[model samples]
Target: MPTDAHPAAPRPAVDHDVLIVGGGHNGLTAAAYLARTGKRVLLLERDDHLGGAAVSAEAFEGVDARLSRYSYLVSLLPQRIVDDLGLDVRLVRRRFSSYTPDPRDPSRGLLVDGEADAASARDAFARVGAEGDAEAWQAFYAETARVAERLFPTLTEPLPTRAEARSLIADEHAWDAFVERPLGETIDARFADDLVRGVVATDGLIGTFTDLDDPSLDANRCFLYHVIGGGTGDWDVPVGGMGAVSGELARVAREAGAVLRTDAEVVAIDGDSGEVRWREGGVDRTARAHVVLAGVAPVVLDRLVAAAAGTASGATEPSAGAAASVAPRDEPAAGAHSDEVPLDAGARHRLARAGMPEGAQVKVNLLLTRLPRLADASVAPEQAFAGTFHINELETQLDAAYRRAAAGDLPDPLPCEIYCHTLSDRTILGTGLAESEAQTLTVFGLHVPDRLVDAHGNDELRERLRDAVLASLDSVLAEPIADVIAMDAAGRPCIEVKTTRDLEHALNMPGGNIFHGTLSWPWLEPGAEAATPADRWGVATAHPRVLMCGSGAVRGGAVSGIGGHNAAMAVLEEELP
Candidate 1:
């Protein structure tokens, strides 16, 4: 599992069956799927580790270990890939306990629905309603749950074809005439109260830039219909953490038959059909494969392939496919431009990052001398399950916090998410390293932006960001959780952004935007932009031998190894069996 210390030089063809670039979740998943299916796959990652965003770094001496310092939360993953990849080995999918405090009446709006007691919870939820709203909400869930149940079989059944859709639409009406409706609109129609509706609607709009008011949000909600509670609840982390999920995928892929190389930064990708070119171990090597599968972003492929073919221009508009899906326009959208982003992001990109320190992000891991004591008794006394608690301010407040960070000064009130890993496994971080207490607080922070990296690698801004986080935590409760700190801060600033950025940088993708091409509601489902479609990035078009398997390919974003699995199936179905 040792990773390369140096970068691979400019290279030629390094032979491989399916040469995969990048070792993040998508790349790893694709590698595992291919390897498991008996395809000769070689995975290269720039980072020393394999998890990508699902990484678990040991920062601060004697710090309790956990998944990616930045990325957390899951259960939105497709179940088909979970069982297929045998992720149960490391996938500890557990939903954390969620609480939203109403400073006025702490108990009223604190608990997330599923964690609430059904009878009393229903009564409490009804409080958000006018008179008879509680039963209405429950009835709505029951109805949606049934549709969600019926939608299960389609998740693993390959991308939807037009014919397939016609045959499959057998009374299962998850998406009806109101497909493009926003979840907010649906919430408005379903309930009246602001607090009640906000808590429930949070589930529908977790990922995606689309505000709750965005029309495509409804389809986002439909995605939840396919998830089954692994006995926990609707939302849960996969067992250990995000690392476990990707680690499990790595195990499955390695066990199947894939060879992985880490820190193998692919300087260039050469050749087209029936062969793959890559550099590894700081030596140029040629890998020959019937198909080349990529698990990074499409932009990575665009760059590698474009560089291989030699292009005058080295970039495309970000989200070109999504923009393309809407309509064809002559001129590009403002700021939808690109070029080689030397080292850190360019000025425009920095503007996009807003007011963060150069290459610095605000990440704080609190290893509590004890568990966090929520002021609310509901979460405090029982502290039943280990789950993620979101410290979400109103949208306006949250936006203002980011605006402040954009201004290069720490926000007065930082937003954070506290995850409890010890609640489920009491001996969580204390397993090997014997310790008296455990740190249940794991925070995902964005108070520090990537615009913070200075020439001399200064960390003055990082310290301030950390202080603001602790201050925020202290503000929540009278007693300082830092008082019980056994571990130090966890996350640090680096070029690695989200998994989307990971895919792009690793694979030379154009924008690093996941979801292959388009991100519309129609694209994610079985019907239009499924895996088997022809308009995909490199999977379907690049080469007869190359299979696209990265986050941009198919079965994307999350830890599901669908991109690799589907690519392997593409090659295997055609060439192997």
Candidate 2:
């Protein structure tokens, strides 16, 4: 709990070339790039640790299993950032793509083995009565692959106009399917099987609470990000878990001469003057910089900016409680703003539109004594659990789940996916645990929005949701999942559940929305404004000095460093002060 300044005597205000708030992976990326250019950079993190939602920890008591506690898997991170920063992290591609067991008949399942030939995949699809979908699947992904190759390279560059991006894609049919029309229409037209269609549609719903046919096209944006990672749809597992990814970024930033401080909670930011106020070790400190990079949600940034303005004008101090409260989907949090700070028209409009994002997911981490046996005896447990294991997530089932959850009720037979990190890399476990064949399962339950948690208290709903998720998992398993769960040294079950409320309290993400808010289209619409370099990069805020460098930025979702990279590029475009 070290402080940036002494408690007895506050330090004089300091100045830097660039000041970054929130020391997440994106913030660390900005610090590394900016500091390497010989610009003085300072990064402050509220928590004791650096990584935001991208850290690995031993969840079970004395388990010695370093599980990725929150965000697992890497799909959107660019190799250019890794090569530029000289990150020493390694990512392993899963041999099996995915395996989804038929909920109607547990004996039949669809297994997508990456190593298997096309004929093998066709046969696997045939087993689940989706033989025709095999060719459709290939065709759909092939189209996405083409889009990825053309669009991914532009993520780290300046923003492209809608027409410019469409022209670059060079395929009107692909554009009409993925970009123009509703994603649901494309899935319906291309795939005949319900399960196959669901597999394709799940990408559109990850961490995003939206229907495929929504006019906003948020689901389409989510799907695009899922498939365009590193110019491919492959989501690789980090060797030492997600911590390795952040650890490398931290090392690079520090080596590049960026000053990163933990346990330093930034309370206010003056966008007009580039001044930042923070609390550390019970002391208040002030710092000013030429540019400010915010690695936070837009809603949170609005509060900070307002707080700063209020302090300057001798208004009442704003409460930080909103950062920890659970908000309904597409609704503003109670006590989110203060009337003491009058907002301009632009700020008011931004807040009204942004509201508080609601994350529709429940993450569960479990340590198993052994992998569960699948009802479909043809597929081995290792193969089934190697990649994403879909459970009760057919197209019809997913729609029903969404409808139920939207009505303030829990979905029956919740749809979820499981990933076994240990199968791809054993480095996360201790030698004894690895030798004992212990495995870790990361379960991500979909369609369970924060609204449900708000209705049912987090504590009561956590247990209920855990039971429901396990029940859904048991449907596809040969034996009860509880039978295989390992016990920790404290004689407790080696399972941990994290709800949206838990995320809000732990990560400061409003409503536990992982992407900070809704995903934005990568390109700007026709007649849109891009007057500044930051705007051109799609990282601009209302103020010229402040820029977004996190998941809130356009093209800035998932574990990708594109947001940070693009923000830095925008700053570098300006002449050095």
Best by TM-score: 2
lDDT of all predictions = 0.50, 0.86
Lowest lDDT sum, 10 consecutive residues, model 2, at 313-322
| Tens-digit lDDT string for candidate 2 (136-199) | 8888888999999999999988999999999999999999999889888899999999888888
Instruction: Kindly report which residue stretches of model 1 are placed more than 4 angstroms away from their true locations once superposed.
Output: 1-14, 76-79, 82-97, 113-117, 126-133, 161-178, 204-207, 216-233, 274-276, 312-364, 381-385, 394-415, 426-428, 431-435, 445-468, 487-545
Model 2 clashing residue pairs (backbone) = none
How many pairs of residues collide in model 2?
0
**What TM-score does candidate 2 reach?**
0.91
TM-score of each: 0.73, 0.91
lDDT of 1 by residue, 1-577 (tens): 3338766654344455677777777777677766776777778776777877666555455455553454555644666667777677434544324555543344434454454656766665544233356666666666555544544344344555434543444433334422445665666677765545544554543323234565555335433432322212255544565667778778887888888887676644543544445656677765555456666555445455545554413332222222221101122223445565433444434333321112223445555556556555545523422554545443444446557756755556765556665555443354643255555456644334333333112355545556666766665554665666664434332111232233334434333332434332212444334344323322463444445665555334444455555555566556542
In model 2, what lDDT does residue 281 have? 96
